[model samples]
Target: MILLLLILTLLSLSRGRPNSSIVNHSTQLLRRLGVKRVPFQFDPYKEGLYYTNLDQNLRQVILNARNWTQISTLSNIDFIRAHNVELGRMQQTIPASSRFPCNLSQTRSPDVASHISRLRPGDIDIVAAFGDSTIAGTGIMALGFWDLMVEYRGFAYTGDGIESWRTVLTLPNILKLYNPNLYGYAVAHSLSADVKRSRLNVAEPMLYLLDLPFQVHVLIDRLHKDPKVNIHVGPNDICSELCYWHDLEAFLRLEERQLYASFRLLRDNVPRLLINFIIQPDIDDVMNVFSEMPDDCTTKASFFCNCHGKYKQEKYYNVAKRFFDMQKSIASLPELQRDDFAIVTHEIFKNVSNLWSRNGALDKRFMANDCIHYSQLAHAVLAKLLWNNMLNQTDFTLSEARRRPFEYFLCPNADRQFLRTTGDRF
Candidate 1:
């Protein structure tokens, strides 16, 4: 009987179906662990964690791919709904106002979800979002706000879990095998030496300054190569506040020179694509804590009081205005109006600010243990925003309320399914 089973297994392996071959091979994996029987039925989306091989296989679907196109129009989503706890305020740690503490968790509002739901997927089916922690869904781990909306779009989810800086190739051609729906997704991240800057905070403004044009070029090029790709670029890359408070005299010089080179390349290579430009509201006022300190030579005195006290939020709002202006300038580039590119205004930071103000109460988990990184709630907001920003179609409509199913998110309890390390490397 064992010999007969071997012959049958060999026969099954010869078939062209990848799953059949996979399951047969998986049966061997089970046998090694003293589990004899294997079910023929498997749902990757729901059961992915159980079989490490399957999870590994799915991970491969995103990392390595080329010559791919994906389609889906409207995204229906489930946000990981959970109760939140409000705990320590940033003021205790930063010695600043309890009101303003680089708090993104407070800024994750869902009204944008409604706007997103109102969009239409049109002809595009796939999306590629590439950038820093904002795109990585930092605060809301289970499902970033973007993921929620993308789900509604009827496309696959491919963004990485955290700040996948400059790794534009996260989901390469190989990912297409399982996600026949795959078009492509790109991620580009730049840090101010890692933790110094948050989207709510501006880190190394110079790195972004120089890399922007080049990254923009890559986005355009990819869009051209694959028109099916609805590309969202620039939000996680630029912060209007940096220039507001920071004297760009030195960095500006570098950017001015590098930007021209990069722009030239982008202009020459970037294809027209449906676009969304990410912008922050009140960046100069709120984020550029240094915008008004006399460029001459000032200590933390003048702005410090204003930052934590009364004028505190005024600058943020004002700086946000300037940031919006810059967004407009960037979008107005002659290329934006071209027949090929469709620019979508992603008033991202404004939405964030709204969330911050209306965040009912704080969820202790919303703040990271380090007082910098966000907790799960934060990532959920990010995923929500991403979902909103990406699906720019006229027909699709999104929900802004926190009405998502808990089960949909890949939660911590799912860790039981973590794959055993294999000796192999991809």
Candidate 2:
């Protein structure tokens, strides 16, 4: 059975298209293997049962070269209905009475920051993101296995501009409320990163930490060539698993050198830039949630982190801690901190696994259909957390934060006065 699964993975990696027979056979094998089905309560639109092997299903479908054809036939109405259902769920979670309206009249600071350190959320002109499939938004909206190949880029927490914060609630969308003319966010979904529609979201699915410099290069090239307005590029890299951690120091050193070089190039060329380095959730923390799941679904952790299943608990914990420390060390590099460019690291996701589970049962809605990436709802929550972090507000424990209504993070009455008085700085 393991050999057959390996064969399927290799076949999916091949460039040649697999026939329908192969796809059907793979699907049957997956079902026979008793893939666990996660329960979701709010499926008003009646999307199929969510499965742990959705990513595997997606791989098979992509190998068949039929993802686009299938998506093309899917109606825009389907997207709309799915969106509406999400909105309905959000409304239930966060009632309107709990929300406080922001004074849109007083948006940006009176003057732009001479140094990136003082840059406010309202001052950002362009929004960008880099990382792996999580940042690429692979399978964010997949209702079933077949829908997994779609890159719902616009719903990504780092750089999405599908609609307003009222609906989609992404970081870019929230920033748009402050700067209406904010450019460079992925406006809608795209099949691939190379497409023009991907815009400033240069993230690619399955990219490793080593691949970040290349993505930085692509983003820089795009900024230089595009005739769009110049100045102020706020690029966020939502980093995930660093690597296998076979040689942790070596991996960190290589990544640091490459990333420093890339940032230095951007700083020298670009006038005003803010680089946000969001620390990913601890792998052990995330894997713990899966560990509690049925045996069939527990293997999903291996898909995201190769070391999780193989390593001892003590070794995994030590490696994970060292990885996070290295990330902070890289962020603190004196050379990378400049007047025009600054790197800010957010540590909110360090304990995010606590947010997804309550009393030992996982909340399936916060996760994507693949059971790997975040769902649209989770992306919205992340956007709020990132925004709160930017404001220098008290960091809410993910579990505590989940209990509060979304509006709790929005415009507070106390903030309104501060926002009104301090139009010059935030």
Candidate 3:
């Protein structure tokens, strides 16, 4: 009887269809070990289709493909929904937003669930967001907002997550990916060391600078044509002390002029462009937190403690605040205000910092070992905040929102996720 059972198990493995009872036990073991793998790989560019791999005995697909076009043609893609099994469709799937206990989850009504189920492919919004580390979703050991959105099947364009990307670099890249025709005409240049100057030199190199007129024209035209697509530009223009209010103001002025030109070209092509900014924790508060630490708690002991050698602390703080204030002023500009163009400022981190401060020092609960970056909890909060913001926008209709609320967001809890171990790396 034991020999017969062993033979049956071997047959099951060879057939690629393990008994449901056996799969359940394996899944439980994987869940306890805190790791799970999706059953199949999906190609996002090709409308999230799945491909099948035949056993060694069968003739393999695309065995002799010489190039990408040929490989694409030969791919044995399984388009039938019944054959393309989704792991998330299982009954015991984990919640998408359950990475941390602090992360909030929404409960939708039955009506909402019905609408979500009825949502078809291409109904989801696709956003091309541009920014530095913050917009890229840099955290100690957490999923970036872009990652979360991608995992949930709400299409968000991604680039080098660690690159020191600026507006000039991002805008052209966005065009290149979205409008290849326009991108063909856009000039290509290496990023300059001086972050303040544009490589194109048509205007001040900042978020507001619209040097590539043709690219912007194509971008707006595409946005008008595709209502499901949106644009998000969050520029962290001021990184060092060299950038100031005048530079940011000048940059915004250039951006406004270009935007106006685009609007004039296509009267109804106004995009729901979100010019969003995040207000950081107060420099004064951060400095006070450092001061309260023991003498032994130097930069070596704690990355955030006594950083800048106490002498340069105030200077860094002052420079940061200068840019922060400038961003607020730009957001308030009457000329920049319009139905299609919206300026969003997030101060939740600042507010939380105040609450977390005790004895003139911030607790490390929501902060990372380095005082500047956020902790896992903070990353979860930021993900939800950004997700909610996306939902509130016109790009996310009610039907779309209903579908994405419960979708699995991959990499919710990744340990040791950051690269380069150093205080100044950030």
Candidate of highest lDDT: 2
TM-score of 1: 0.39
Give stretches of model 2 more than 4 Å off.
Answer: 1-70, 73-100, 192-195, 231-249, 294-296, 313-317, 403-405, 410-426
- The sequence of per-residue lDDT tens digits that candidate 1 reaches over residues 168-231 is 1122111222233433332212121111111111111112433444334333433544444332
> What are the Cα lDDT values of the candidates?
0.30, 0.56, 0.29
Question: How do these models rank on lDDT, best leading?
Answer: 2, 1, 3
Winner by TM-score between candidate 3 and candidate 2: 2
**144-247, model 3: which lDDT tens digit per residue?**
22211111101111211111111112222222322232211112111211111111111111222232233333334334444333332222222221233334
Give me the runs in candidate 1 sitting further than 4 Å from their true place.
Answer: 1-122, 136-180, 186-207, 214-267, 284-321, 357-377, 386-426
Each candidate's clash count: 75, 0, 1
lDDT of 1 at 82: 23
Q: Residue 388 in model 1: shift from native, Å?
A: 4.1
Give the per-residue lDDT digits (tens) of candidate 2, residues 11-69: 22122344555445434543643434454444332222225445554765554464443
TM-score, candidate number 3: 0.35
